[model samples]
Target: MEEMLTEAACRLGVRGAQVAVLVGGELREAATGIANAELGTPMDARTLMQIGSTTKLHTAVLVMSLVDEGLLDLDEPVVRHLPELRLSDQAATASVTARHLLSMTSGIDNGFYDDPADYLATLSRMEMLFAPGDGYSYSNASTVVSGALVARLTGLSWDEALRRRVFEPLGLRDCTTLWDELPYHRVAVGHAPDGSVVRPWTFSRASGPAGSTLCSTAGDLARFGELFVRGGAGVLSAEACAAMHVPQVSLPTRRFAREWCLGPYRRDFGGTAVFGHSGTNYGGSSTLLWAPSTGVVVGVVCNTPHAGYPLAAEVAAEVLGAAPYDVEPVTRLTADAEPYVGRYAACDLRYEVSAVDGVLTVTLEEVASGRVSPPVALLPLERDRFLPERDLSGGRGWDLAFVVRQGRAVRLVSGGFAARRMA
Candidate 1:
């Protein structure tokens, strides 16, 4: 299995990758690639990596724990608990409940620029993109507001609430919310694909609730996955764990990935439903997944900012497919060649999907934002499967791809973008 993973990493040109398989509480660590591409630090079990939006799972766990204690209600308006929050849409603001935020159906647009000055104000300024519960749009503003709600209800900072309810009890010594908030030595420095170290600037702190501060080692993350696979014994109740698996929204179609639960993006890998979330920051990426029925969990931590799914998927497939556990990869079929071909843009986000000379090409609207490059070009890798050019971000050369289901692109598999188009 180690050799297989090493070969995959070499093929993908992953600079630093760590894979940990947790079976029935036992763990196996397989690592290849350099943790520090410059000084030649090999990734191992103890090395910490940023687990971006996967941090939302932990936040969701904390919210569920509060619900379990009768201190919070999922159906109640979040504003009822935290009266200070005022959305620009008065009606949605009054009606939006905690559940709406968690499910990413808050009708809010994603407008989080990497500007600290606009962070707090942006949440209240963006108009409700749709009515609450109308559709699912992955909104950073939605989650950050959730963090604020938790803080308001508990009368504690989100970090303190997380510590009291999660980290300490789970014995996750290395896990933390804000990496910079922690002592400098313990946090892993994020890196570009070329091995140049990159630290989060002022803009990073603004992305708090959605994909903010989470730092952990593969060992610690495996332990986290184990708790979920084992029915959330020490952390949350079985009922709470069950709620986490309920499907709240149908994701865009993708061939390589599975569907999504309320919060976690899931896939049927090796005959078991692998429940987990993939995360990406500017220069780091991580994933934590587990199969409860099989008692198999997998954790992959990487330093180069955007290499989560491939590492996690490869590890889970190898360890979970040991024996007796067998499942077929669902072959995705697509036929709609019209609805998918269009130029779509909302606010600062832009992309165009069109059939050019019998081939479908999706181009990013580069002239608009003018970041590192334009929207990524995705070339078909298989039937309904496509792989993006690595180093597309100039330095973060993660060769990720996507699957088109029906006419919508599902999970952003390669880039770790957690967006699904609305119907």
Candidate 2:
């Protein structure tokens, strides 16, 4: 397993990685390379890897605990608990429920904000992608709002509530939401695609509940996954946990998961529905996948930003004999990629898609900083969905689906967010 970890991470250009596999009540652990390539710190069990938005699972579980206590209701409008809350859409402001937020069905776009005040203040003027529960779009803003809801109802900060509810209940020792606690622990800093360290290491704190501050060791993360595998393990009722794995909304592509659950991702493993989640920050990523049918859970931590997909995926593949990213080979291009050639906007990033030599190419431009990413080829995997051929970053594949309106394409949907055509 150690050899496999070293070989795969090295092959993928990753500097450091740690993995934990839980199968049939036995847990296996392995680590490879350097945790901080810059400092030459070796990866170990103590090295805490930022799980990014995979922290959403923790928040979701925390919120579900609130539901179990009769402190919150998933179907209730969010404004009922926090009357001051308001969205850019008037109808949505009164109607958007907690279910929409956790399920990633909220229309709120991912925006940078300072705190809850700035988040709500900015969202009040911003337009959403669609009506609440009408479409699926990953929203850090929505999760932040739900985090605020957690704070409001619990009379405690989001950090305090999560620790008391989810973290402590599962007996997870090497996990935390506090940034100051990082200095005392073995931590893995992020490295950019150029192999440079990710400075600042953190993004918007307002989105912390959406996974900005969450960090954990691979074994500890696997233990958290085990809680769900145990059917909530007394912290959450089996029924409540079951609800979280229930499909709230379907995705545009099945290359990953066919649908989005209340908090975790819902996918099929050997015909049995399984739940898991993945998260990526600027230069680091992690994944916690649970295959309940097989009584297996895979937790992987990596210091490379794009490592979330294939790193966790590769480890899981080694354990389970196959992973989700191993797609059926697209031997020949059958779909027309020309109609999708246009500019599309997704939150802070804008994409410029053009056909070079009649092949679809995507160039990413950051709206806030005006940074442009190198153009990459998008190969057709299915009808309107295409897979990104890995570039220098070693980032793995994600399905990019074009949404057509009228007779032309109007949006490029990838991951969970839709990049609306801006050209």
Candidate 3:
């Protein structure tokens, strides 16, 4: 396992990483690379790496624990418990529920935030992407608010609640949301694509619920994953544990998954379904996956940013002994193609889907940098979905999907976010 870990990290240009896998009734572990590239500090089992948004799973478990205790209702409007929550869309602010937020359908803009301390206040200046429960847009804004609600209802700060209910109860030795404590732990710093240390470390404390500040070793994460794998491990109710993996909403894009649960997104590989969440910080990425069928739980934390998926995916396949599942491509268009062609923008990033003489293509652009990518041909797929013939950056393709309203694609959802159509 250590040999495989080191080989994968070296192959992927990862500087530091840790992994923990639970199989049958035994747990195995591995670590490779450096905790600090400059100091060349060796990564180890005790070295903590930012779990990134995988923290959302812990947060969701915390939220679900409330449901088990009868302190919160999943379907009840979140505002019912925390009225101070407000969005630019008053109705959505009022109507969004714990279910919607946890399921990524709250319509809150996963807006850019400057300060974690202003997490809730930042909402007042932001707008909703869609109506509550109307569609899915991965929103950190929604999760932070959920954390705030947890604080309100538990009469404990979100971190405190997690420590008291989860970390303490599960006997997780090294997991924390507080950044000040990182100095005392063997924590991994992040590295950018160029292999340079990431500046400003992290922008996670304020987005704790959305998974920015949490850090842990691979073993601690795997143990927490046991909650889902083993009927909540008696920490949370069996019913609530089951509900978190059940599809609450589906993403039409292959970029994520076909569906999302209360916490993690669900995907199938080698015909076996696995539920887990992947998270990315400034320069790191991580994933925690558990397969109920095999009773296998895998946790991967990589300090090398932006490319953690391949590491996690490879590690999971190695542990699950999964085989490749080939998917036949859809060559024929099944839906009206006209409504899908449009220009969409999220801040300075742009995507333009166009049809020229019957050949459909998408042009990606970084408007702020005045850089435009070569057009990539798009093959038609079912239900208004499009498979990029190749990635905009010239890598393998990821399928794309749109949110259509009144006969037009209102947004292009791919590459981890939904870009609003620019009319």
Candidate 4:
């Protein structure tokens, strides 16, 4: 495992990494490379790493908690909770729901590029590409709205709500929403790939719901995963936990590394469906995935900005596979996977595929030169498989699959991979 972490970091060009794997309620910790690669500080268990979008799982739990309390409805409109969110277009404002925001179909583009101040208003001003709940485009603005809704429902700050409802009950003392307020004596400063200490940006407290105000060690996160594995640890009821894992929408990469149930958890790992969240913040990456079937929870945190959340996924994939359980491979055919074999025009490349050895191997051709080169081969595994060819050193794979529609494969999913099987 130590060698695996070192190799992963080196492949990602990351200077340092820390990974924690939970198996059957026991955790195994490993650190490789350096935390401050130039300063000679080694990555360790206590290193304070960021868990970016993984925060969504936390917020989702909070949302479900509110549902358990009858304070919010998963199907309710956002305007019912946050009337202040007036979009530039009134029609969109009228139709968008809390579900729209939670599921990332709010029609707002990723808003991180805009100044934090303008985030909400800018999102409001943007025209809806499709009606709410009609399609999916991941937007931080949606999660931010979720944070705001939680605050409004509880009449407390997001940080306070999370602490009183989650951290305190879970005994996650190391976790806090206020990263800027963290005591510098114990916290490790974040670094870029080149080893320069990154200037900490003030995460928009208003937008923090989407990606802000959370910090903790792998140990603390493991405990949080345990709570969910234990059906919300009396914080929420068993029924509610089950509801959280219910499929709220059909997503492309819905099941990667694990299945995308309602909340951030995957269903049926080694036959156990664990419920938990995965997060990545600027300059940090994290993953807290567990398998209830085996009672194992893995929580990983890495401090390097570019270490990326995919590292957590790499860890999860490895951990789950290593568990001592039998996963009966479901035999599904790839015969319908032929149509996806044509050219996909992206910004700069043409994606093409050809059948190889009864499987699909993808090739990204540089369009200008028409030079074809091999990419990681994506094989069919009961209708889906991981990107067998990504530069796994940084740890991100789409785990793509061929979506069969109308008795034929029609689309290739992102995060979850799919390609047309061409002759």
Which candidate number has the best TM-score? 3
True-vs-predicted CA distance for residue 47, candidate 1, Å: 1.9
Candidate 1: minimum summed lDDT over ten consecutive residues — where?
323-332
Model 2 weakest 10-residue run by lDDT: 325-334
lDDT of each: 0.64, 0.80, 0.81, 0.63
Residue-level lDDT tens digits of model 4 in 328-423:
323323454465565543222346655654456666665457886766566454444434445422345345544455655443444522222222
lDDT (Cα, tens digit) per residue for candidate 3, span 1-423: 889989988888888888999877587889988888878888889988887788888888888988998999999988889878878888887799999989998887776645646678778776567789888888888888789888998999998999898999999878888877878888888988678788787875678788778889889999999888888988888999999988988786765676899988888867888888888887468888888888999999989876687787788888877833435455633345688788887644688888776667789897557898888877776566777777652222356788888988898887446778776
Clashing pairs in 2: none
Write down the lDDT that model 1 would get: 0.64
lDDT of 2 by residue, 165-198 (tens): 8878878889888989888888989987667788
Model 1 CA deviation exceeding 4 Å by range: 39-42, 115-120, 180-187, 199-203, 255-258, 322-343, 353-362, 366-368, 371-423
* Of candidates 3 and 1, the better by lDDT: 3
Ranking 1 against 4 by lDDT, winner: 1
TM-score of 2: 0.90
Task: Give the residue spans of candidate 2 off by over 4 A.
Answer: 113-117, 270-272, 325-343, 352-363, 372-378, 388-394, 405-410, 421-423
